[model samples]
Target: MAGAGSWFVEQPPAEPPAEASASFERLYRAFLSARAALGLALVMAQLISVVLGTTPARSTLALSLSYAVAALALWLAPQLRRGASARSLARISSPHWWSAIGVDLILFGVLHALDPSGVNYGALFVMPVLMAAVLSPRMLALATAAMATLGLLGAAAWSLLAGLDVGLKTTQAGLVGSGLFAVSLLAGELSARLAREEKAARGSLALARQQELLNRLVIDEMQEGVLVVDRRGRIRAMNPAARSLLGAASGELSWQLRGRADWQPLVLALERAYGGSAGEGGAEVDVALALDSGAARSLRLRLRFTRQREGSEELCVLFVEDNRELLARTRQEKLAAMGRVSAGIAHEIRNPLAAIAQANALLAEDVAGGRAEQLTRMVASNVQRLKRLVDDVSELAPGMQPDTQPLDVSALVQETCEDWVQVNGVEPGAQSRFRLHIGAPGLTGLFDAEHLRRILVNLLDNAHRHAEPGAGAIQATLDRHGDALDLVVRSAGAPVPHEIERHLFEPFFSTRSRGSGLGLYICRELCERHGARIDYRRATDAAANEFCVRLRTPSSASSA
Candidate 1:
């Protein structure tokens, strides 16, 4: 009995272990059901005995009815304890050998002791033994089997004292005890093995879920677009980059690829991959999508397939990249390399340029008013142009921060326009080719004064080159736009061609044979450094070509 007491000793955990608690509750409920059924069977057996005229004792009938009622109460306990804490529920639901097994042992032992019709009640002991084996610890299970063995032997010894066949009864009791012991050990080991497998399965499921979330996060943040599509042209999944590249709305996640005209190229690429035109590794294709904006966007697509195993559908993974962006990135890399080389070349040219300027100045002094004087002047002008070119190229090198300060934009624009007109020899007054209009006085902006001057000079020069020689052929206006200032230089001319407009600010792109092509590029670069923007458009109201520079005001810069 002391060994049997070990079955009831359980330490309540602070927090119930999920897997262990669930497993115990499940097994506990199943055994409770078994106990209830057994109790009913015992009551039915007693009633049948009475109907057959082999009436059992009144005490036996009372014991069977009591067991049935006890079993029913235990089975219904879990439903009454709902919403309880884990520790509380665990205590109520945990399978203890005493709850089911101990009750069954006492009932069977009493029934065996009070045998009325000489029925063998020893077989009933197997129920408690088997229940203990499956639900209790190994030592507890063995202890339970030993207790049942003692009960059987005691019954056999009592029968011998009553002059029954003692030898036969003792041998049967010994054999039954041996079988019970074996069942207990074997069942306990199998139960432990099952628990281990269940725990491993739970860990694997948790790990797989974590990995899935991490993969989704990584894909969403990727710069390149990623799409997962099945063979049926259905877009199963797509990351944010993919949605942006496809111009698809965020909520249009599950749409078919073939539903839209712009998506036909993707459908064809998917078909090619599935139709085996794509290699085992994957395929790459260039596609053009005509968007709602009436513009054709180019994309480079690489399609790869998941390994097609039996019983699983094959999926295609499409990696999409905007071809224009790819080209821009490649161009930037090339430009970076070119900048390094150009910086070196500009440095080497500086010494020679200085020597050439010195020689030109010395030579100009010796010349009189003749072709020699004109030649020296041209040499000096050309040298100045070379120096300007070198300066523009050097500006392209990395790590040049703008030295910005608050300045009067109105005064700068007026001064720059006046100086440009004088330098380019434009006549002032009613018939002046260049007209300057200052809309507001004391309009201050944040800018590098030198950079702003260079930007204005470049824009004025471009306007001068394109403007017809007449009154107001070019107009430079400064005005306020929101919290910023806009300096618009409009020149009377036909609008720039669309083909050339796209590359208007690109480096080394010029229509003239001798044009260095860095004027607008350097202007754009300078504007960007000063946190401003410059763009070109045909002014519809003025019916002229306009280059507008939007300068950041001090207040706007401060707020930003």
Candidate 2:
């Protein structure tokens, strides 16, 4: 028995395959059910025979009842209810032969030997033979068949020893044994083939699920929008980017292509794609939508379709991109390239500019207080403007880093405003056009000193250009709020136009032809480097354009 247990034990691979274990559990349960059903059928047949005045021997009745009870017990065993727990009970190598195959063979053999009313029970042996062939190894199945054949022949030999007619009995047992052997071999081969096909199908299904998850992850993280739609205009799937482009709320899931008036253009595009040639690769289309907020949105869409197969539904995939955003991205790339080239050119202009200034100074000395002097003065002024432009451009060079340090916000604002007023030749008294107010004295902030000065000077310059010439026409105020320092420059002028305000900090964008357009842009870059923010708004109290610079104080910076 020990040797038989070792031989029949299933030697699973180092990492047992999940599919193989699952298949074994399924077959095991199926055979248990069949055994229970056969047992009940035998009991019913015995009761019916007794009713017909054909009562069997008392031992035969008891044996049939015992077989039914044992079969029911094994079928409903708690350990066999779950796959993990069923492994030991279901293994063919079990030492005790506790399975239905062993029980069926023993009980059916005894019943055949009883020979009640000479009714043959030999046909019952087929159940155990087929069960072993499908559930156990090929050699084990053959062994089971041999055991049953031996029991049949023994019963026949027993009858022969009793001096009964032995010729017909021995011949019949021999023929049944031959048939059992063939059944065992054929059933075992067929079961093996089915198992192989099932394993392959399960492997394919697992691979397909993994691929689907990967595609979903990639689509969700993409910057461009993606949509999956069927021919009936129902949205099957949509990525985050697509939802954002459509201005759909985050919680909204169900959507139809033709559900809203704004989505009609998309509906038409989808229809065109489906109605056109099946071989068409894809096409790009422009769509304009009127939003509920009285605004219009422009989008570019690329549509493609899955191959229309015979039994599968065709789907359309739309790649959506906001046209305005696309244009802005392209423009930013062009400007970055231009800024690099301009920085190089600005570096080469410094030497020539210095020479021109020296030459102009010399010419002024030779021809003072005349038309020639005026021409020289004009040349000097233009040269200074070009030099300022060059300086601004150099500050914006790609690799430039700020020299950040702590400084008194009030003192810096006061000094920068005084210098700007002197350079621009503004008056110094109460009636002066440019006014400075210091609301906080000891406020310190982290910033580059020279960069801060440049920012202040640019804001003052912009203010002077737009403000009326009167007292408090341009106001520079410094104040502190909690751990922040704010410098607000306000000018009493008409508010900046909405269209131009959006591009104020963009490179090379300006309303004035003579403006270098680098002043505000350079200021914005410097502030960003120092962890500061600059924004423009209309001062409702004064009805003036206000530009506010918010700086991080030392304590706030340290905490961060």
Find the candidate with the highest TM-score and give its number.
Answer: 2
Q: Estimate each model's TM-score.
A: 0.77, 0.80
Q: 501-559 in candidate 2: lDDT tens per residue?
A: 99999887888899988888988999999999999999898769999999998899888
The lDDT of each candidate is 0.82, 0.81
Candidate 2's TM-score: 0.80
Instruction: Give me the displacement of residue 115 in model 2, in angstroms.
Output: 3.2
Residue 296 lDDT in candidate 2: 82
Clashing residue pairs in all predictions, respectively, total 0, 0
Candidate 1, residue 415: Cα displacement in angstroms equals 5.6
Model 1: which residue pairs collide? none
Report the CA-based lDDT of candidate 1 relative to the real structure.
0.82
Task: Summarize candidate 1's per-residue lDDT along 411-452 as a digit string, tens digits.
Answer: 988888888888899888898888888888999999988889
- Model 1 weakest 10-residue run by lDDT: 1-10
Off by over 4 Å in 1: 1-27, 44-57, 76-196, 221-225, 229-279, 287-299, 309-313, 322-325, 401-422, 425-446, 469-480, 553-560
